[model samples]
Target: MTPIIVFSVITGYFGLLMLISYLTSRKSDNDTFFTGNRKSPWYLVAYGMVGASLSGVTFISVPGEVANTGWTYLQFVLGNIVGYVIIAFVLIPLFYKLNLISIYEYLKDRFGLKSYRTGASFFLISQTIGASFRLFLAAIVLQIAFFDSFGIPFWVTVLVTISLIWLYTFRGGIKTIVWTDTIQTTFLLLAVTISIIVILSQLNLSFDDAIKLVTTSPKSKLFEWDWLSDRNFFKTFTAGIFITIAMNGLDQNVMQKNLTCKNVKDAQKNILWFSITFLISTLLFLILGVLLYQYALANNIPIPERTDDLYPLLALNYFGLLVGIVFLLGIIAAAFSSADSALTALTTSFCIDILNIRKTKTVQKKTRLYVHIGFTMLMFLVIIVFNSFNDASVVSAVFKVAGFTYGPILGLYSFGLITRKKVKDKLVPLICIIAPILSIILNYNSEKWFNGFKFGFEILIVNAILTMLGLWLITIKPKTSLN
Candidate 1:
């Protein structure tokens, strides 16, 4: 009858993951830790990324997004499919051709050390904040679920949760993460499907009937063509394209998995398959949300103050004991699928980028252990900072922060990869850093000057363009030598 049971089950699940991590990590060295030896199966990585990409934010936030934006978020998912195709065909091939350990290494080869470090440092900062904020959101959920029964402080709960992730990921890195993520994704999807069936049964409706009810519901209707508003079709699709491309294509955390594929062909296959799977899985969640809302309405369940709790609250309270357990499992599945990957990717990037450990042939286990622990503690610190703010929404704030930092990154890469014009390496970092700040200022008052048309995801597109322009302006032409 209390959250103690829920918490216990969740803790046990984490224990299982840690056990798997230890088993996988027993003899893992630097190559295995960072690249998974470039031997990971593409299918496994693709399937696992379904869960990693969605994460706790999607588990809670997608339902809330529906409540606010209707089913039009699917447009963004559609855009993601397009973005994935582009990455599979365009970006992955380039990365594979370069045979890069860290994607940022390409910048160094093309431009100079300053560009390389600039890109890598930006990723470290953004991903660290992004990953920490994600864990903080999940920790908040756990805190709320256990507030009465456990009497644990929020920060303590965060440390306990993150420490478990660190323990699992400290050794095997991507090899361990690939398999574990597949397991976690299974639970995530299964939990949602089971909860959906339970909610429908309580409504005395069959699965087909539930589908009909949802399609007819206002929330389930898709296709919004308005370009002037928040969830507009063009804007959502465009935003989706940019977000997925920037986040998945340009990001070290996400792309590291792709780069682990045996070859460019395999990596491209993974991206394509991942696109299909991600779209289908999200559709399943949205359908579950519609059914959940219908069940709540039919039974007169009181909606929570924040819509994020709608799905879980309905299952835990309205559907009662068995379904409550299932709901808790879903929440935990979504949260950990993401947290584990984030932890692994965070350590992998740091080891490869900031620390430059990958350049060496011999890295000690102790060094890797300390590196993993440092990132683990960093997660704790980031969550504390997020908690300190307490006002911003986790998903939106992350995107906003990303918009500033990642936009310039997108531009820098686009220029170097697509253009022949050389950029001044010394000025690259400064331009990349300043572009986002200026974009933020422009975006702040964009609507005031544009007749109430606010900038959306296109901000990243523009930000990247500006960086490209800056790179062009700052680069000095080659001079005639003494010959």
Candidate 2:
């Protein structure tokens, strides 16, 4: 629990990551960095993705949220199961058939050059914001447990930790991450498993008793039949489906891992198996949440005002040494698993989609290195900005931002796939921009204007619909060709 122990654990973990980077990336090139030479194992990719998908937000925020919202988040996970199936069956085949390096390349083939860039640009923006939020959570925990003891500032902690991520990821890129994620995912799962065992032992509760304690507690309340609440079952389940489609199916970072699989069948297999394992991991975290609150109450520990702080506070100060060590490792693994992938995916997007260097061998490697460093710095700044203004739970904040940023992408993919109509390509960017702004406006006024209707994460669905409408307005008639 001391600063020295926390710092040492991080140091040792980072050293192991660097070693993995060295082993996996020794023979790496631009091809390996971008797509892992299309040779990653389906099973490992599926398992590691469990860690990347959860990230620091889920590690810190989800359990804390239980006291407030209970098992309502489980509805969203059920919807994610539905979404992941759609990705495996519907989206993966399209990417594979097109032979896409950047999935946004589908936009260019389906629509036009401008539409492609719009899609890629939105991904760049969305991934950066989302990645920053994850890293910000990790950085805050590190600052409190380690740096604060030495009077170090938050920015310095971010810079140093992010530098460590950049050091490991810049060379091997996604190739290293695939292997590294497997290991990190192990640590992440272990953290949860160990916490559950420790809490159960401390409370003298067996497996059956723990289940009863959770179910019998008022905090375990799941469904909200009320139509207007943000966390209502209908809204969350529906929102989870769309959010996964947009955030995972449409996201370059998440899809990048899937694309690394050897072929279409492998990628689909990876996603299918990942959904099953991911559901198990999520349930474990929710169970841990219940145990954490119970532990706090029985021992006369005062809960922190912010749900995000509860796990860290209890583990570091109250839950004793072993849980504390595992907690730090788990959070670090969760944050870096996603952040490292995001950094690689962003660099890949810029070099391939924005710069059109996917075909050019010359200067591509050098250019990629520069872009990698540039995104690292950009994420550092974004984390600082988020730390300044983030008042809501990090999980809610991530999805709220995703609604506005990722919505246009969902619309673009839907428009191109479901309909053959082409749009005035030049207007695509304007439509993407306007859709999110309008969603924000509608969200602000919904209670009054919609007769006390509160928008949940369903705002993402509305934003995507508005974008599709805009695209339809700009559609040009498909020219009929005689066979």
* lDDT value, residue 231 of candidate 2: 86
Cα lDDT tens digits, model 1, 52-168, are: 887877777677656666798798789889999889998999999988777888888888889888888888787888887777767876777675456778889888888877777
Against the true structure, candidate 1 reaches a TM-score of: 0.95
Off by over 4 Å in 2: 361-363, 479-483
TM-score of each: 0.95, 0.98
For residues 1-483, what per-residue lDDT tens digits would candidate 2 score against the true structure? Answer: 888899799999999999999999997899899999999999999999999998998899989999999989999999999999999999999999888778899999888999999999999999999999999999989999999999999999999989999999998999999999998899999989998998999899998999899889877888888887898899999999999999999998999989999999999999999999999998888888988999999999999989999988887787779989998999999989989999999999999999898667575788999999999999999999988878889999999999999999999999888998889999999999999999999999999998888999989999999999999999998788999
User: Tell me, what's the RMSD of every candidate?
Assistant: 2.0, 1.4
Q: Name the best candidate (by lDDT).
A: 2
In model 1, which regions exceed 4 Å deviation? 360-364, 479-483
